[model samples]
Every structure is written in structure tokens, then in C-alpha cells.
Target: MIFAIETAALQTFDGAFADELFLVARILFGGVIAFIGLNHFLNLEEMAGYAEYKGAPAPTLSVGASGVVLVLGGLAVALGAFPTLAAGALAGFLVVATPMMHDFWAVPEDQRQDELNSFLKNVGLLGMTVLLLAVSTVEWPYAVGVGLV
Candidate 1:
């Protein structure tokens, strides 16, 4: 019985540690999104220029919309409010944007490295988003508050 109790206590500690790590990751990732979103608004012209260079249609409008989504979704994720939905939206956006906006595969070999890095980063982000969605469905702030529970 004592051994069982010790094991259970250890498990609880592990769970708490995992939760803390997850929260820290959520904050860092969300902060990056928020920063980039703010940059979109503050550097609207630069964002539009990048969009146009990427051959995106209606560069200005696209920049604006992406900026808004990033800002709102980032905040939602950071606060652990509606995390699942926010993560889903971000994943979807990355799916589309990675190929359309980044297009690392199409670049020259020398220049491709950076683009590939960006592409891989987006892929990782997508994975995180999906994981966050899964966790949100299983946990309190996300499940109960967001109705995923």
C-alpha cells in the first residue's frame, strides 16, 4: 500500500510537471504569434510588400486579415481560453500559408535553406497546434470553459 501510494504521488508530480511545461510552451508560442501580429499592423506596408512578392492576391487585405487572426488567436491561446478552436484555426491557416506564402520548395538551392527552415517551422507549429487542440479537449480551462469537455 505504501509503495502504491508513493507511485501514485510520483505520477501526480509528473502530471503537474507536464502541465507546467505545456503552459510555458503555450505562452512562448502565443507570444511569438502576438509579436508577429503586431508587426503586421505596425509594418503594414512591409507586410503588403512581402505578400505581393509572394504573389498573393490583394496583398494589403491578406496582410490585414492574417494580422487580425494572429493577434486574436494568439491572445486566446496565451490565455488558455478557447485554445482548441484557436489552435485549430492557426493550424488551418499554417497549412494554407506554408505552401502558398512560403513556397520553400520552389526556391533556388542556395536560397532554399531559409525557406525550408520556415516551412519546417510552420510544420512544427502545426503539430503544436494540433497537440494543443487535443490537450484542450482533455483539460479544464480549455474543456470546461471552451465547451470541449
Candidate 2:
């Protein structure tokens, strides 16, 4: 199983169609992440209020900082620039924010399902971040070639 996983992780795409698909996926993924970050700014007051409700320290500052991280990281990923740093920022954000922002178990019964859905969505995104991290050492076929690795 370990070998299979390794093989899969190391697999490379070499065709035009595959390249386009990978590039499109990156753009879509990064676009959505960037949009989500932008949303933090657009909804700052509401998001800060929720953060305060969750007992986050310096809720306003935290939200703004996270928004910057997301915007920068998402753009890097989309542009294929500094993928390792970008992925790290994104993964870090998700790791910390997921539980704090979407703690279904801690929410009231009426909001539990909504929070659970968000938690699950974040988990899926976390999985994608891990995948990007795993491939950060490789030259991305359609990337802008701005990464140190």
C-alpha cells in the first residue's frame, strides 16, 4: 500500500490534454481560495463578529491577517509561484481556521449541520493542500516557474 501510494504520488502527466487539465484545475482551485480570502475583507465586520463569538483573540486582526495570507497564497498557487510557501500558508490557515471557525460539535444544535458541512469542506481542501505540498518539488508543467523548489 505504501508503495502504491508512493507510485501514485510520483506519477507524472506528459500529454497536452493532461497539462491543460492540471492547469485548469490549479486556476479554479486557486481562484476559489482567493475569492474566499477576498470575502474575508468584504465581510470583515460580520466575520469579525463571528470570530469574536468563537472567542478568538483579536478577532479583527486575525481575520485581516488571514485574508492577506489567503490572497497571497492563493495567487501564488494559481500562478505556480513559490508553491511550497503558498501551500504552507494555505495549509496552516486551514488547520487553524477549520476547527475554530467550523466547530460543529461546539455549535448549537440548529447550526451543527451547517458547521459540519463547512468543516467537511475544509477537510477536503486540506487534503488538496497536502497533495500540492507533495508535488512542490517537481516542476509544474503549466506553472509560471516562480518557486524556489
Residue-level lDDT tens digits of model 2 in 18-105: 8788788788889989999999899999999999999889999999999999988888889999999999889999999999999999
Candidate No. with top lDDT: 2
Q: What is the lDDT of residue 98 in candidate 2?
A: 96
lDDT of 1 by residue, 42-131 (tens): 999988998999998999999899888888778878777777778887888888888877787888888798888888988898888887
The alpha-carbon RMSD values of the candidates against the true structure, listed in the order shown, are 6.5, 2.4
Q: Tell me the number of clashing residue pairs for each predicted model.
A: 0, 0
Model 2 regions lying over 4 Å from their true place: 1-11
Candidate 1 has an lDDT of 0.78
TM-score of each: 0.80, 0.91
> Model 2 misses residue 76 by how many Å?
0.8
Error of 1 at 15 (Å): 1.9
RMSD of 2: 2.4
